[model samples]
Target: MNDTTATLDAPTADDALTRPFPGASPYDTYVHASLLNSLQQPLTEAPDEMGFLVTTQVMELWFTLIVHEWRTARVAFAKDDLDAALDALTRSRRALTALSGAWAPIAALTPARFNGFRAAFGRASGFQSAMYRHMEFLLGDKNAALLHGHSGDRAVHEALGETYREPSLYDEVLAFLHRQGRPVPAHVLDRDVTLPYRADPGVVETWRQIYTGPQHHPHLTLGELLTDIAELVTRWRSEHVMVVRRAMGAKPGSAGSSGLAWLQRRAARPVFPELWEVRGAC
Candidate 1:
């Protein structure tokens, strides 16, 4: 073929796929990848510090996602939409699993490696993560003292204060069940939302009925799904403790908290109390 004919006939199929954007790639623009990359300014020269910072930041993102899903689930339950709530809970469960797996990179850090950069981040601790606190609040682990701790940041404190006053994911779940004619106690439904949730015998009995009833019931399905979320949350906390123990071996945590011991205590607390109690009776 002549040069003109050959050139015209040449494949143009891949041009659109390979075309460059006017400024930034669509993916970068949408995900703010440039901004995210700019955030990992590690303060140490330690080889492991970068990985540690990245892993911790990634976990924070996962925490944000889990909190978002939980809030969605809570709203769904409040609206009496069980299917939507379950879907959101399932998403959070997957996020929790991924969050636990995030420990893999730093899980085996030697004391020397950890010490290489630990002091670089003075007074900064994972315990002070506002997003993580949001996750805890959603799980009915409300602590007014913890809420007050963030008061120095007015915006964060106000936002957390709202979560403190609002019904938690578990609270909405129980209210949904009560609306469906389950025998959840009036006192539980009336309890102040600001306080940390405590297990009630009436709630245990309510769960017991659901557990013993028809296996295919929707309430039973909800119980199992909630149990799954709780297990995943506990698994993530336990993994955190394991990672800390390996890295520092009971050294004091940043921000003045007891490191391993504090994490151990947190990991020991049950996520949904009545759900577990109902199992023994079943």
Candidate 2:
């Protein structure tokens, strides 16, 4: 037989590769991809709406992954497991980068294009994203009013309340540093966990010691990794502000926020404030 004929006549291995599953494919079952794909039911036929909806949904999933990783890191820090905590923080940093990248699809929407479907999703603003709030809470930006906003949803409220009650990831980090013989102040260490973490002079001193120590110290490496994560988060927030400006300049947000102004103010708040402060001190 000719080589071409033989190749065509033979049952190729590709057949098995393409074989269908009995019901849902293994990939679908494991990833719940069917359910995820089913969620993008845009409320309007405007072309830009799907991109906007899908981008927001994608960010929500990223937020979920980031929160999971941060929680893992927080637990690791609590156990004084530096390696595990660093691994988790590294994963979360990657997720934040991806979250920031997810804005590309909707980032350049013209105000007219956005206005087409913006009114349809009335009062359904990004401000109401519970998972994003969880991320903020984890970053030590606790807000009682924001947490209370989810009170109508008992399951969400209860879950978020626990995060509200618990020490943030940064808090655990300070406690871990204190255990490692750094002079994290007792008052700062024992401060109320539910309140927003302000930049404490003592915490700045603690980080300053780490930053100014031997150049190759593990603690300094940890500080830099955390700084990377903080910068990525800030970049994401700044990109969010730019996207809002492009889509709808200065318009009030659907959830009653002052839109661009409110987001600009929020983005101004630094994550890991002492870490940033220590750089200048060093």
**C-alpha lDDT of all candidate models, in order:** 0.93, 0.94
Model 2: per-residue Cα lDDT at residue 54:
89
lDDT over C-alpha atoms for residue 198 of model 1: 92
Clash pairs (backbone) in predicted model 1: none
Cα shift from native, residue 147, model 1 (Å): 0.7
TM-score of each: 0.96, 0.96
Report RMSD for candidate 1. 1.6
> What does candidate 2's lDDT look like per residue over 95-192, in tens digits?
99899999999988999999999999988989899999999999999999999999999999999999999999999999999999999999999899
The best candidate by lDDT is 2
Candidate 1 per-residue lDDT, tens place, 37-113, comes to 99999897999999999999999999999999999999999999999999999898889889999999999999999
Model 2, C-alpha of 72: deviation from truth (Å)? 0.4
